[model samples]
Target: MFTYERKVTYSEVASDAMADVAQIVRYFQDCSTMQSESLGMGIDFLAQHSHVWMLTAWQIQVMRRPRYFEEIVTGTWAYGFDSIYGYRNFLLKSSRGEILAVANSIWILANTKTGKPERLTGEMVQGYGSEEKYPMVYAPRRIALPKTWEDLEPFEVRRSDLDTNNHVNNARYIDMALEYADPGVNIYQLRVEYKKAARYKDKIWPRIHRENNKLTVALCDKDQKVYVAVEIATDEN
Candidate 1:
């Protein structure tokens, strides 16, 4: 496992004074990069080798929300890899060791020039050192959308939403999903499956399905191609 520490900054807080959901996603991004960098597969290393990794899906469960100004320890480890995907897990813990959240994710490596999935090299797999443990296990590829749902106003992607990939960042998709869920609901779990990349000026229609404490969301384009699908399980409190 690899570990890193970070403090929740004012800019990362939401109106409720808790760290924004997307901020947690950013932490995950940082930890994943840092961990991989240590094992010789950092962004620069991969770019030099003509490959880049893309997140395919996520399953995150929050036990307690981290507040603004809190210093937290974040950790991640790769548990396994297969033909085209690497399975990893992460944790967010308070200074005193309380788990704030835990997540499991799937990632795929692609050839930068071809944009096609590639199998991991033997050396790369050995370097990551599979740990075979998890905080959660989830359906990695699909997030089922309900048959009946309502669509919200379409969102236009701005320059600020794009990342180094020149497309909508994965965290931004989670933020868009959160914006469409019930405000009073405290989300305990959030699962997102990224289907396509959304670039600047792309307009996405957010569709929502709510039943009891469970919510489902899909961000799509004018042609109804889903960019991302989300599943949120909330607690009454």
Candidate 2:
């Protein structure tokens, strides 16, 4: 596993002075990206080969949110790869060595030109070695939609929401879904399934459903087809 240490900045924290869930997700994302970059299979390399790694799903569990200015360590490592799909795990820990969060993610190597999944090359497998999967109850990549949904106001995608790939950044979907979540609820688990990429100026029709301590938000298009499905579980669950 590759690890890096840093202090949480004010920008990464919520009003409560604790790191926001989205920021926690960002930490995990960065750890994986840094690992890929170090392995000579980063963004530049993928772009040069007309390939890109598309994040298909994320399952993260937050044990505790570190406070502002708190030093923490973030790490990630590949656990497996199958066909065109890759599996990775991430961890965030406090300076005291307490695990703050852990995550499992799925990614697909795709041909940017044709938008089709590409098989992993031999060099790709050797570059980044695999490890045992993180010890956590793994959830399915696909989240089941509720029978009914409460439609909310539509949101137009902004330039800021676009990532280097010109698609809505994975973390941005979490930020958008949280807008419909209960502010008082302490989210302990988050799962996001990215169905399709949303480009700038696309209108997102959000719908929410609440059952007990679990809240789900589906960001969709006008036709009601989902772009991203976010499932949040509070401690009460």
Candidate 3:
């Protein structure tokens, strides 16, 4: 089947300075669409495929926020297939093909009732979309991770961290934004943009700088490519 693709919108951007992690997650939530497609792709093998696609984990990185009606391409294709699970990679890019974000996920097919995965069947394996280019690459859109985090500090997000998606699972920006913390100070305020999706297991480092109650934070790859810019508010109490 053809890979799913589309542009992005303003609503998809994270704007509130006091926004919660779950709010930041809406930017990448296509649950209904992705769910339908995922199961649909299971084809006749879904029930008998032996293996199931469970959301074992994910590594996601977003570079910058997409403007309303921004011409972006969202693509999802198989990254790799194992006997027990299938690894997939996703990308969001500018119309010009500039990659804005990259994400990888592992899924397993298992008995829904028993929660046990079975080996992938030939048909189950064949039905998946084509293998993604650079299947092993962790982050294709990002340049090298940040060389170093010169300054680090403490921070926090509160009830605001809870969003419509319910929990911060809408994405993991809250955790990403907090990465820069030294555990020396308590976080009082946080504001971050949703440049990309922070899927399960995506390791994000928060680079921090502070002036009294004002804090600046940026989310980056392991190498530390600053992707999301953050603003913080603190009372120092």
Each prediction's Cα RMSD? 1.7, 0.9, 11.2
Residue pairs clashing in model 1 are: none
Q: What is the TM-score of each candidate against the true structure?
A: 0.95, 0.98, 0.49
Q: What lDDT tens digits, residue by residue, belong to model 3 across residues 119-205?
A: 776765666645545443342222222333454432333445444323233345545555444443434433444343343344555
Q: Score candidate 3 by lDDT.
A: 0.49
Q: What is the C-alpha local distance difference test score of each model?
A: 0.87, 0.93, 0.49
| Least accurate 10 contiguous residues by lDDT in model 3 | 16-25
Model 1 spans with C-alpha error above 4 angstroms = 135-137
lDDT of 2 by residue, 61-96 (tens): 999999999999999988999999999999999999
Which candidate number maximizes lDDT?
Answer: 2
Question: Ten-residue segment with the worst summed lDDT in candidate 1?
Answer: 132-141
lDDT of 1 by residue, 45-74 (tens): 998888888899988888888998999999
- Sort every candidate by TM-score, greatest first: 2, 1, 3
Worst-scoring 10-residue span by lDDT in model 2: 178-187
- Return the TM-score for candidate 1, rounded to 2 decimals: 0.95
lDDT of 2: 0.93
